[model samples]
Target: MRKTLEEKLVPPVPPAVRRAMLDAREALPPGGADVTARLFAAMKENRDAPTLPSSKSFRDAAASESTFRTLLRCLARYAPHICTSNAVTVSEEWYARRPKHVTMGKSTPVQPTIWPAAWRALAPALDAAPIKQSSKRRYRASIDRCAAMVRAGRASSDFGFVAAADLADAFLFNADATARVKPITAAGYLDGLIALGRFGGIDRVHLLPMQLVAEDLREQAAMMPKNKEARIGAFMERGGFGYAADRIAVCLRRAESLPVHSAAGRRALQTAMVCAVFMNKPARKGDMVSWRIGHDIVRQPNGEWSLAWQQGKTGKNTEAGVLWPEVCYILDLWILGGRPDRLVYHRYHELEGLFLLSQSECQAYRNLPSELTLSAIGVPSHDLRTAAADYMRHYDPEHAANVISAHLGHGSQKSGEAYRSECSAAAGQSEWQRSRMIWS
Candidate 1:
């Protein structure tokens, strides 16, 4: 008789060993549960295995190279006694032997550009242009898309040459069908084409039409409502800044009581710290990730915490005054308690001074706040900065301009105009409501 799938999955280990594996599984983050279970099952099946299964055996069972590495880390943390001294070394060697630059899963074949001759003709001019390398890369990508469109018979072709019409047609392809061209994307595409024309030494008289189209696109983009405005308004309407603050406070409280070694607890503490810093300082994402303990974030003699960093965008030295006490408390808990416990086993020394240790952790720090709030607030992390500015404008209208400029590291007071306008609109709406109530 054939065994059931559930029966096959169950590890045929002794009761004591099974219980130990279950306990170790609980310490793992939610995503690690399945992989950890599989590891234990493999261990139970191999009677010759004293500790972990061989690297080759485990690699066969793993979904991907990334997953195999993740499982190894989990074992090192939760069941370190079972992991051999050379476990990580063996896994690293196995990873190194795998094919380079080759994606694991089924991948779409690369499509050759239709106008190779045109691209070859344009490549030299683009490379030699005295523009930023980033700009050159953007132009090359835009030209590639134009060539693809022409190949697909979706855009005009001028005797196998890519022209302005083809560039415009490529912009409208919507090839992915996921979203239409956003105003900002349209602007980027137009800019790339303009730069390409100049680099190709096309006559200004012939380029006048493309330049005019670029200006029109910029006008349309300016007229469109700002995403920050919409996000701020939605977040404010749904209990505003107070709601996000309350959520962070709840996470911190829960995290404080849980064991530092618990992955879920460490995650909760990290999320609270991320949201709190953004709420108080409103720094850009790059600065937040790059922040170091003794350098960018510091504690003063008065026992208050302050943050100062050279702004990545503007290259200006910006600093924020003492953070809120709640923010400071969460930071202390994470730095002193949760962080060290989490990183002790792996890559701790390499990532000692950084605020966020890994890309996955950084993404979670940026994303989890919004998830916890049910997407009603703090989406994209930057929205927290906008909310902070909006709250000041609404409550402390007199100091809103200067305060926002300083608090958000904005280069000029004019940047606070949108927040001020939002406050005025809300105030006018309130007055209209009160007038109706009196008349009624």
Candidate 2:
């Protein structure tokens, strides 16, 4: 009744490759694709069964049973007929729209404007970043609606794109209002405040701190149990202030010279740094944090590495595990600060977000565009992992999937596919965009 993938077919491993894998594991790293390849090869030649991640890691990667089903699809692609699946009808499928509208249509060849898309990118910063209690369901509804619209031909590639050749208006978003273009009234600000108190985190729509909600948030935070710091961090991040947590993580990483003498900075720094450590482990931030374990990281007889807490923002479910070097560096930094057991990345997340906010505060004093300042890096904390994926792909096309999957702690490979975020990195982005306009 139960057919194990490992029991089926195996890939042949040469002695030379085995030696290479052992050498690399001892010297270079453990999760290197070469090691994985060698292990697969050995399984074929010697009929040696494969290793698995600790159950804790696997559970972390698979937040729910449905998520595990998705993992089966990824496995089938990577290793054909390796895993089994229970097929469900297409009528059972559903969709969910994300944070905002995504327009995918035929390209009419709009030229890139002289204005940097950087400011538009930065528009998400400030008091505007907010997600509501009702928002997620609304978004999910939107996706379902979008799917139906597509199927009915109400919206399709034929619907076409905006005709503007330039994006002088893209930066023109309603910051003081809902993303729906409504003016941000007192009620809107209040709605944002309630959401923040309910969901605080970097990804939260309510990114900025509110003078009115300050006391309320503090009271709410104080009542949360000490062990539930993960939830607290999520609340902050979900409110669009997760970056603040990241800054705190950065501070913890380099806590040696941080000016503790500055009262506000020290307090904010300490709070953010501590949160990053707790929040770094997998969990969604809202009223509370919930942790899950997956099969991949389970300590089964076949599992290889020991299970440890993950540092992915989307929790273990969507994001893959951190790279060994990156994880080690984070741990070493934590040890240096005499806070080895403390949650490191959550602190970094807090520190990073606070630092950005402080920088924006300084910018506000000068009346400069803080949005432009934030987008200078062109990406966020998580993009570094995707950047790493792109870097790996740049180095090798074939082995990119395995290394990226292990690195990001994902149960599957879709995130790696979504790594094509950068315009230049996308397959067809250059087809229409020209570096030179032939001015001569």
Candidate 3:
């Protein structure tokens, strides 16, 4: 007469635990209580007794699930035995005093880290800067790496005065037992250290020279020549790009032909629309994934669609682009019939993201690279972005750098150079074609 899994899982919350949960609800911001209650109810379904998350566990989870962090913090203070993280102790002080220095977010209350006195000196400025929590973690990690270098006798003790040559030696040669650090990582470490110094009232004249070295290293890694010519040649030899647009059109047609009830078929249409938009807009993946239906995109009364773009990486918040009518039609089909998820954060917030993938569906695409593979027609996503930029400059000789910059939503003309460089090989082909026509 053993109980079934569902029966075994339906244990009631203990009296003490319920009291703690009530306290957590009270601590939460308006509307956060609902999120906490839902989270608690979900946790109660587990067979095991409630326990605190580990320090590392809480740190990692806090980044994605801020509500979980909030509840955990409150529970930690109320019932210490259930929680083990040092954060629990910190939370007690935080909730009681409500320090003026502490910053608050929608879900989780920020707690001050116990850094070394020397490092703590830098916290005020760092905290004041308008950066995300994930970024703060990265900056702290970089600082720790640099400090490790110093402790290992590889660099100057003074983080401010650490020389470029020392950084190169430590980063490039693996002065420690670990493998040589990648150039990109080395560059990030350098940038983080410089930023820390800058915000701490360090002089620019001192930081700039070291920063320049890091910049050069980063550019060297990024601008390293890739044999795209060889890859393209091999691809063409295999009959690729023989009317690529026609292939795209056929893919779109196949998507349209799919049965209305098919989720997989609708996903295919979503992919097609993503490709179409990128082909014309030169949008980065971040931009495409985070787009909303109403806020980012709008349909005008005159039957035209406009996209309001904000390139997060470049800090360019204002840019306008056109959305072709055909693209808009596909978008409408996906929005109306695709069964979008109702994300409940701000109740008034509309348009539950432009491209809504289910949790399971997202997991399926987790391993897939950012490349289009519609019925065996595979193409790297960046290729379309590069092609658009190339067509702008190489095919249209009158196109200027500024024009290309505007099209790509780039903050500077310098950013458009990579696309132009890719088109250099095509220049000869274009000239040869012109000469053949003249000879005829």
The numbered model that scores best in lDDT is: 1
- For this target, which candidate reaches the highest TM-score against the unseen true structure? 1
- Model 1: per-residue lDDT, tens digit, 1-440? 86433343355433444455466554555445456567666655654255545554465446676676676666556554453322333455566777665567655576665554644676678789987664677677766665665566765533222355455545644676653565556556656656666787767776677666666667777898888777767777868767778877787777766544345566677677777777777777756766665567775544467778888656689987678887776666665443333333243233345554222223223334445334324576777787777777767665566677777887654766776676667667767877999999
**307-426 per-residue lDDT for model 3 (tens digits):** 886775576864456677776665554443322223122211333443332211132242132455323345565554555565566656444445667777787757777655545546
- Per-residue lDDT over 1-440 for candidate 2, one digit per residue giving the tens place of the 0 to 100 score: 64332322224533443444344434433223333343344335543323222223333334344454454333333333221111111101212212234347543464432212322233244225464424543333333322332344333311112201011011123232332211222223333323333342323333233323334434554565543234334433444234544554555444443322223333334333224322333222221112121222211222221224433333443432442333334333432232322334433343332222121112122111122212322222343344445556555544556655665566555554554334225434443344334432
How would you order the candidates by lDDT, starting with the best? 1, 3, 2
Per-candidate TM-score against the hidden true structure: 0.58, 0.25, 0.51
Candidate 1 weakest lDDT stretch, 10 residues: 357-366
Clashing pairs in 1: none
Better of 1 and 3 by TM-score: 1
Error of 2 at 109 (Å): 50
- What TM-score would you give candidate 2 relative to the actual structure? 0.25
Off by over 4 Å in 3: 1-120, 130-157, 160-185, 203-209, 227-270, 299-305, 315-322, 337-380, 400-402, 417-440
